[model samples]
Target chain A: MSVKNEKKFNVVYGEAVGAVAAHSFGEPSTQMVLRTFHSAGIASSVVTGLPRILELVDARKKQQSPIMTIRLEKSYAKNYEKAKQVKAQFEEVLVKSLLESFTEDLKNVTMLLEFSKEKLAQSDLTLKFISGKLQAKFESIETEQEGNKLKIKYKSKKEMKSARTMFVNMRNFAIKGLQGIKKATVQQDDDGEFYIVTSGSNMAGALEVDGVDKEHLYSNDMFDVLKVYGIEAARNMIANELKKTMDEENVSVGFRHIGLLADAMTYGGSIKSAGRHGIAGNKASVFARASYEETVKHFVNASVFGERDPLKGVSENILIGKQINVGTGRIKLAIKKEDLKKVDAEK
Target chain B: MVVHEVLSESEAKKVSAEYNTPIDKFPKILQSDPQVIKIGAKPRQLIKIHREDPTGKYSAYRYVVESV
Candidate 1:
């Protein structure tokens, strides 16, 4: 590498990078839009702006709205029909979604389920498919199908309460597609290539579907990325996601600061939040941990464990009004034995 | 995943000596990690990762720890 490039990448020892990263993220975040805008149609509502920054930093297990952008294989990407077919494999269909109305005939101990023909057509499912799935779920119950309806007869006539419970259970039964995925929509990207954007994320299951571009699949959920792709990918995701979120708000920040933050968060081989419960909480010095959060808890634990603070870190030294160990404060004067003998004690 | 290679025992020792740190003290990667599993690495092994940065490319080292 060139000297200039080497210098650009090297962080000076004793430089407070954590403080710099914090300031870099903190200043621009003030200008971020507070409101989250929901796009029309079946597209997932993305959490953006200041809220998104918090979501990434906190590393929340359950996202407000997790989304995934699934790319297709080369042959399928150029065709709209192929992309739609892939989308159907991800969008889940529930029995209740296709039902028009369900009526229970207590006298006959039967339930009449009215299926909406329009919904069935839109979902690309037939009466047979639905009936077959229902039959598999309840083998003992007898089912008779009409034009757009099915009549289910319970074996035991007098058990009215059990029949009511069965109705609730049948409605929630998933007939097809990956579970947890609420909806999937096929969209055309800038290059006229078709892809699928889903409201929910099921990375492992989605990867199994045909025509999916396994290498390029992306999810907004950090845990999913960590679980599927491992630590390095998760680290990159954090930095890229942070940069993308900032770009959407028109805020300009250097990638270096964001990269530094990401490296610090994942250098320990796992994603850790920047605050109290994670990185901050794991500081080696008791005083540093106490100063950040849960002050009394940290102090009591330290005392109980007979923990000693070396007073090496910035926070601990600052707490005692000593110079922080950074920049010029990092320099210490040393007197050689011969020089010490030469120095006047009185002076 | 980034481009990575599992180092031999001798190579791992050389890295540990060069960095002036013990092998176990290095940053850890779980043995069950997908990338580690893909590479078929075992516990107490070392991995050298080639990372691409906008400024330049650099190598990072990780120690494989048994998954608990």
Candidate 2:
């Protein structure tokens, strides 16, 4: 006879999300050095640094000394809290000047946007005059085809400068709003508001304004998301330009919401993303324009060639050394042709 | 191994609430490295948490049965 035993059971799960955050590394050529960590299944990666030295020989039994190399990287951690800490440290060390760059970016983008509007206004004078002739019921937009002799499909419609102005201003506002975003230590309030209070303020009084819901807090409020993140792509163009400052400071700005960000940056312009046709797709290299493709290729080729040492193999090994593989291998096994015949006869 | 037939934050919170289970009460090893895990954690991921809660004792367990 047997008795049955019972136990209780329950079910549960964990939540995960894709994150956009800045990363850092202790050295350059960090990838190879960090591959070992990956081998052990750790979620960390390194990019660009050298483990060995390079030497040059000018002449006369003399060799040049090797130069020191450096590496920089952004590391990703599986744990969000841990990742946030590393991100905070990286920004403190490298991204301090981002605030100033963003301000300059806002000014530059504003100027460009104004210039574009003026050019558009001047080129379509005839359309502007005809736009008033159209009836208010039509409320139609006047189309003109004048730039580079391009043809306009609307032969009798009118133009709306106010609409254009609204678009431009919205875009500009969006640009200015996005300009001051920096990746650093983000503090989360008890109510789940996220704010990045860096060492300095890029927005001047914007950060100081008081409210229950402060500016720059990504509270996931739809209005806040729209006011800040959902800005027109012009804001992104300005933001992209501002990122050059990060480069100057030896830092990097991670790509924001690449879709809406691109859309806003290229607003009243072009739509670019990865599909059958995209702006980046036209470029053959696998990276952005500023990335180092040629330098990377040259270093890789030289390192591979050095290890092989083709010149030394043929000239030194073949010519200077005795017959190679003599002990391990032989021209013929055991006996020469003449010696084999004599040995057979003796047997 | 804790098998989750369905996984969600709300569900995890609900189940933890029902049972009053704490995070530290589960069969898990805590370490600072996060890279090294005990209790069948694979290389890429550090550990497998059973969706434990801080107020594990707050949850309650209940069952129903019919007698012939």
Model 1: docking quality category: medium
lDDT of 2 at A66: 12
Candidate 1 wrongly placed segments (more than 4 Å): A1-9, A33-44, A95-174, A345-347, B17-19
The lDDT leader among the candidates is 1
> Which ten-residue region of model 2 chain A has the weakest summed lDDT?
A51-60
List, residue by residue over A1-347, the lDDT tens digit for candidate 1.
46466666577777998788889887877756432343224353677777788999998888888899999999999999988888888888888888999888866778888999999999789988887888888776778999899988865565777777777777777788876689899999899999999988889888899999998999988889888988878888899999999998789787778988888788677888989988899999999998888999999999999999889998999888999999889999999987787786645
Query: Which pairs of residues clash in candidate 1, taking residues 3 or more apart in a chain or in different chains?
Result: none
**Two-chain DockQ for each candidate model:** 0.50, 0.01
Per-candidate total of colliding backbone pairs: 0, 32
Local lDDT at A312 for model 1? 90
State candidate 1's DockQ.
Answer: 0.50
Number of the top-ranking candidate, with TM-score as the measure: 1
lDDT (Cα, tens digit) per residue for candidate 2, span A1-347: 11111112111122111112112212222443455344555342221112110100001111121111111112222334544543333221111111122111221122111123343343332323322322221233223334322111222322455444532333333111222232335455454434344332223223233321232232211122222322221223333333332343344334332222333223222223322234332333222211323546544655666633332221123343543323232244566899989989999
